[model samples]
Target: MHDLLFTVPGDEFPFTASVVVHVDGPRHVVRRTAGGDVHEVECTADDVDRVVDEALEALLAPIQVCRACGTPSASPDFTAVFERMHYICFHFEFEHGDADRDQACGLAGCPAG
Candidate 1:
């Protein structure tokens, strides 16, 4: 399970931005904070993939979604993976749900995550 938290300024409308994404196994809870308003989204899946590569890709998607909304972001630097701790970055890749075989980054020397 993973939970990602982000704080958006009290502006920027017409663009639905991603604020916080809470993951518990296959279920997802996406919460939004913008314009002094708060919204919650819930996604439920049957099970969470545990493969090393899939787990890594699953870890990066929310930040990618966030960066698409014009929020300030840092380069997609590699960060340590702590237990249940979240990563915040600007990198994105479409996994097709198969991180091991999908080479989305396309960069020769870059890591999958």
Candidate 2:
């Protein structure tokens, strides 16, 4: 089994993001963390690159709608989460909108109303 870690930082998050990738035979696991929150996911290890790509897509794919105005954000900031010793892309907050309300539009808890 192989393990990998990464740090993602940007203006949106304003924090150091941590991600971990684990490859074990046919099972692949990822954990990621940002802003003190953690999230993880698992999949078949067809290929390391493929698994990472799919996992990241799955994490960022859900922010198509603007949780604050329900109008779909033109540009969204993305990040990841962590679990114990693993990580994956699962944390995100919307940008380019009402700065007062944007902080409330996180991917993990968007009212989308």
Model 2 TM-score, all chains together: 0.38
Q: Count clashing residue pairs per candidate.
A: 0, 10
**lDDT, candidate 2, residue 66?**
34
lDDT of 1 by residue, 3-63 (tens): 7654433424453443666787667766665446666656554322223223333434444
lDDT of 2 by residue, 25-70 (tens): 7888887765577777786655657767644544434444333333
Stretches of model 1 off by over 4 angstroms after superposition: 9-18, 45-113
Model number with the top lDDT: 2
The local distance difference test score of each candidate is: 0.44, 0.50
Please give the lDDT score at residue 74 for candidate 2: 38
